[model samples]
Target: MAHPLIDELTDSSFDELISTAEVPVLVDFWAEWCGPCKAIAPILEEIADEHNGQLKIAKVDVDSNQKLALRHQVMSIPTLILFQGGEATKRLVGAKSKRDLLADLAEVISN
Candidate 1:
């Protein structure tokens, strides 16, 4: 199951959420059939819990929101994009360890 804090983003809600967020928004671009995406979900949930106020977590299902996936140039599953100041600051593709995920966010969240 998805964490309560993680927002399920669609085409309409995607731009609004990312644009208006006060903190860095980490968006997970995934598809239902993607194994790597599923593998990284728990790590994302933990990050969401650990960094609740410092960062915002959102997920976009590539299948449901094809336009968003295309717009973001998500060529692979489990694509994680960190959006700061309404622009994509970091992009991580494929599954990542919790340590790596946290390390990637540390700089962004601290700023």
Candidate 2:
């Protein structure tokens, strides 16, 4: 992982991660073949750093975790879902600028 604060989530670990999370969990559903997914990686990393203890950032490889992706209804790559209290409170589809991404997330997660 490029960011030390980011967690790589798999099908098995998905539930436990979200359910037991102490703070909001931002899950990124992406695939290696997705150009937009690659484009958003660094922005996510920067967010992870800026938000440090306020929230947690996680990534699920859609290619490797198809079941998890389907469970979350990830229809597009670079889908960012923010989970609060084990429920998805916000979702953003496609790659966006760091400011825009943070603005979307700030709606559900308190900066």
Candidate 3:
């Protein structure tokens, strides 16, 4: 299940959430059948809680948002893309530990 801090985004709301967002939006492109996606959820939830105002965590079901997924070139589930200034700044292809994520995010967000 998605944590309260994590937001579920649809194709319609994708642009609005990412482009106009005050903080960097980490968008998770996932599917219900993806085991890796499930594995990454906890890390993302933790990030959402820890980063709060510094970052915004969001999820988009690839099955439901095919167009958005295709637009983002998400061939793999659990794809994490960080959007800042309305553009993708960093991308992670699969499940990663919180430490690794935090380290990687710090570089992208700090820049």
TM-scores, all models, native as reference? 0.94, 0.94, 0.93
Rate residue 92 of model 2 by lDDT: 88
lDDT agreement with native, every candidate: 0.90, 0.89, 0.88
RMSD of each: 1.6, 1.4, 2.0
Q: List model 3 lDDT by residue over 58-87, tens digit each.
A: 999999999999999999888999999899
Clashing pairs in 1: none
| Ranking of candidates on lDDT, top first | 1, 2, 3
- What lDDT score is found at residue 37 in candidate 2? 96
Residue 18 lDDT (model 2): 98
Best by lDDT: 1
Q: Rank the candidates by TM-score, best first.
A: 1, 2, 3
Q: Compare the candidates by TM-score and give the number of the best one.
A: 1
Per-residue lDDT, model 3, residue 81, is 93
Clashing pairs in 2: none
- Give the lowest summed-lDDT range of ten residues in model 1: 102-111
Better of 2 and 3 by TM-score: 2
